[model samples]
Every structure is written in structure tokens, then in C-alpha cells.
Target: MQQSEALCPKFEFAFSILSRKWTGLIIQTLLPGPKRFREIADMIPNMSDRMLSERLKELEGEGIVMRTVYPDIPVRIEYALTEKGKSLESVMREVQKWAQQWVDC
Candidate 1:
């Protein structure tokens, strides 16, 4: 086995995705339900629209987020967690609980 993969393959893979900026938060936001692109963007302070779009696309590529478009005059689009994405809820909540207990902020 490769040295890095042997050490902690699962963790390495999970962290590679979760550690990206705004990724965890995006997952958290989607836990409630699907939301529009703008709604997700608004949840995070100081996050640029461009960045949000980029992150959403990245998550979609990973099969963690699904994008749906409605046929409307304005072309409304929304983002939601797929079954794969919803799988991370427990992990995220565990992290939140850990942060609550240990994080200074």
C-alpha cells in the first residue's frame, strides 16, 4: 500500500474535502433543507458570490450536492445535499459538539 494511504486513507480522503474553505459550513447550511444559491451565499459572512458558486460546483462534482433548476422567468436554481452529502450530517454534528466543548470561540 502507498505510505500515505496506509496511514489513514479514510481520514485523508474525508479531510481533503471537508478542510476546504466554506465546505463544512456549506454542508451545515444544507442540513436544514435545500436553499437557493443566494441564500447559501448569504449564510456565510464576507463570502463572495464567485467563491460560493465555485464551492457549490466542487461539491456537486463530488456528488455531495445536487443542483436543481426550475423553469421560471428568472431560472431559479437551488442546491441541496444528496444522499451522499446527507451522510455527512452525523460527522458534522459530532464536530460541532466537539467544537462547542473545546473551541474557544
Candidate 2:
């Protein structure tokens, strides 16, 4: 029998980011467009503000998410996906399609 090859490091890194709790949901939620802190928190139920904040920061650091701050009277802030993150749209769509067919809620 042929030997199985080891997992690719890039795939491992991507999986590591996606496997984290709340990461996928956060990315999915931002797929439509940019959203404020409260908007994201509201869209994803059961995710604490602290956890949301933490996950956003991690995604931002990974260059997957872009955080914008508008210097207004109240200082509006929004989170959106960068080009690198937006490239995952097809991947996300595929996962959603697969889940719809195979995943039982």
C-alpha cells in the first residue's frame, strides 16, 4: 500500500484558524458587509461581547478582517472582510451547501 502524505502546513494553519470557537460564525456574519460591534454581537447569539471582541482581534491580526474607525461625534466603528478574507466566500458557500445536505440540525 502507498504511504499517506502528511497534512500540508498551510492547510493546518487555515484549519487552526477556522476550528476555533466562534471564528466561522464571525466570518460568516461579516460576509454580507461591514458591521458595528453591537451588530456583530446581536447577529451571533450566545457569543459574549468579550469573546466577540477577542475573535475579531484575532481575525484582524490574521489580515482576514478589517476594522475601521470613523472619527465622528460618537466614533463609529465597523468590521469588514479584507480581500484575503473575501476570497473565502466560495469556500464558505461550499461549506454551507454541504452542511445543508449532510448536517442534521
Candidate 3:
């Protein structure tokens, strides 16, 4: 057992991203399809506009979400998960299953 591992046994880089507040739920919400800003905000009940904007920016910085702005009518904007983000789907699903199984006990 190494000194570093002993001191921080659960210091995982991937889990760091997964552990962020609302990050898991946000990723789950986007699994169905891409969405506009307002659409996402509306769907996530009680999610403040400011917090959503900030989290989206953070996810974008982390390469999990891609934001696109269109130049056509109404200047549409949309957000979608990147390949990196899609990779989390299965991980989240397994976690969901485990949680439900254990939490019910």
C-alpha cells in the first residue's frame, strides 16, 4: 500500500466529475436527446436558470457537453452530450440499479 493511496483511497479523477452536484442528474436528463437551454431548464423542475447556465458551462469545459448556436431563423441554440459524456450512460445506469437495490433494503 502506497502512502498516497492510503491517504486518499477514493480520490478518483472520474468520480470527481461524477460527484459534482446535479452533474449526474443533468447527464441523465440529456440521455434522451439534445435540448435547447429553455427546454432543459423547464424540464428540470426547480432548477434555477442561473445554476443551469453555470453547470452547462462547467460541463462544456469538461468536454461532456457541446453547445451549438445557429445563425438561421430565431438563432437557435442547442446542447448535446459528447462521446465522453455518452460513455457515462452505462456507468450511471449500473449505479442506478445498485442504488435502488440497496436503498430499498
- Return the top candidate by TM-score: 2
Candidate 3 backbone clash number: 0
- Where model 3 places Cα greater than 4 Å from the true spot, the runs are 2-11
Task: Compose the digit string of candidate 3's lDDT tens values, residues 1-105.
Answer: 777556454557778888877888888888888989988888788788898898999999999999999998989999999999988899889989999988865
lDDT of 2 by residue, 1-105 (tens): 334576678998999999999999999999999999999999998999999999999999999999999999899999999998898888899999999999999
What TM-score, to 2 decimals, does candidate 3 have?
0.82
lDDT of 2: 0.94
Per-model TM-score versus the true fold: 0.90, 0.93, 0.82
| Candidate 2 local Cα displacement, residue 19, angstroms | 0.6
Residue pairs in collision within model 2: none
Question: Candidate 1, clashing residue pairs?
Answer: none
